[model samples]
Target: MIEATNTDLNSPKTESQSGLASLDPRSKILLACGFILTLSLLPPGEFLIYGLLLIVLYISASLSDCSPVYLVRRSVIALPFAFAAVTLLFTIPGESLLTLPILGIDISVEGAIRFASIVTRSWISVQAAILLIILTKVADLMWGLQGLHTPAILVSVAGFTYRYLDVLRSEASRLRTARQARSATLSAGRGGGTLLWRARVTGWMVGSLMIRSMERSERIYNAMLARGYTGEVKTLTRFELRSRDYWSMLVAALTAVIIILVAHFL
Candidate 1:
C-alpha cells in the first residue's frame, strides 16, 4: 500500500527545529548543488582545500542540527564507489610509492593522490545529499525540484518511487514471513535448506514479487484514473523565499566561488 505525503514544505517537523530545516528548500537545493560542483572542480593533491571543505560541511551540519558522527557514519556509503578507482593505482604513470607484495607491481604516487581525492570528493558529496534529505522531506524535495524548473516527468518518477518504497518493503517483508513459516527447521535449529534449494526459492520469490507488483500497479493506476489522476504531480504546499533565504543563498554561492578560486589559483 502506498502512503500519501501530507507534510508541508514550509513547516518544520517535530525533530528538526527552526534552523536549516526552516530555510527555503530551493536555497538548500541550490547550495548543495553548488557545493558538489565546487568540490568536483578541485584537482588532486589539494588536501588543504579538501580539509577546508570538510570544515565548511561540519559548520553547515551543526547549523542544521545534524550530528558530525552521524554524517561520517552515513558517508561510508561512498567507500565502495571509491574502491572502483583502485585501477588508477596501476594505470597512471608516476613515481612509485611502493610495490605490491604479491604481484610485485608498483603503485604510483600520482595515482595514490588521485585515489584519495576521489574518495574525499565522494564522501563529501554523499554527506551533502544526506544533509539535504535530513533537512527536507521527500515531498518538499520534489516540490523544490518543480520550483527549480526541473522536468515534470522526472519529478513525478522520483516522487512516485520514493512514495512506493514502503509498499515494496512491506510486500517483501510479508514474503519473508511466509517463507519462514513454511520453512522447516533442522536439528541444529537452523532452517532446513541446501544452498541450491535456498537459491531456487529466492528466485521464485523474486519472480512472484514481480508479477504481484505488476498487478498491484495496474489496480493502483485504475484507482487513480477513477479519481481524476493527471500526468503532472500537483501539490498544495507552496514556497516563498524570504529575505533570509535570499541572504543565505547569496552567502553560500559566494563562499563556494571563493573556495573554488582558492583551489585553482593558490
Candidate 2:
C-alpha cells in the first residue's frame, strides 16, 4: 500500500537516480523477492546469516534514501503480526527454561529460538518491502507486476483497491463522526460501552458499513460499465528489462547465496 503515500513516478530532467532507484521496478521486484526467499530458506538458528541479511536490509534502506526514523516507523506496522510467533515459544517441545506460575506452561529453548527466527524474518521482509515501495512508484510497481505476467485479475483487484481506499476511508470517517455525535453524550466507559454492549454496537456498525459499501460499489460498477470499461486495464507503456537488470539480478542472487553458504558452513 505504498501507493497510498505520495511518490511521483514522472519527474522532470535533472532528478537524481542513484542506487536502488537506478534499477527498473520489475528488476528490483524480482531481486527483492529472491533475496527474501533466500533469507526464508536459511536454516533455523542461523543467526550469523540472519545478521548478514539484516545488514543487507539496512544497505537497501540507505540506497533507497530512506530516513532512519521513517524506516523504523514503517517497520513497526509488521510487529503486531509477528506476535503470532510468540505462541511458538510455548508450543514447540524442548528443554524448558521456565514454567508458568499457575498454568505450569513451559518455555523451551528451541521454541524461543524458533520464535525469534519467525519474528526476525517477518521484520526483515517488512523492511525490504518498505524499501522497495519507497524507491519505486506504485504505478511502475503495478506495471512491473504486469510485465512479470502476474495474474491480470490480481493486478486489477490491487489497482481498484488502492484507487478506492481513500474513498472507503472517507466513508469510515463519516460513519465514526455520525456515531460520535451521539456517543459523546453517553456515559459508556472504555471505547464507548461495557464489553458486551460494545460487541453488539460493533456488530451493528460493521453490518451497516458493509451494506453501505455494497451499495456504493454497485453504483460505481454500473457507472464504470456505462463508461465502457473493459475487463482489461491498460497502461501507456510496456517496460522492458535492460542489461543493468541482468547484472543487478546476478549480484543480488549471488550475494544472497554466498551469505547463505557461509552461514551454513561456518
Say which candidate scores most in lDDT.
1
* Best candidate (score: TM-score): 1
After superposition, candidate 1 runs with Cα above 4 Å error: 1-14, 180-200, 222-232
lDDT for each candidate structure: 0.81, 0.76
lDDT of 2 by residue, 1-266 (tens): 22433433332221237777777879989877887898888878887678778787787666656654565667787877877788998999999988889999999999989988888887887777777777777767888888789998998889888777778766766766677666644454446667798678768888888899899989989998898888777767566777888888888888887877877787
The residue-by-residue lDDT of candidate 1 on 120-231, one tens digit each, is 8888888887788788877888889988999888999898887776787679778877887899878786667898898899899999999998998899889888889976
Prediction 1 global C-alpha lDDT:
0.81
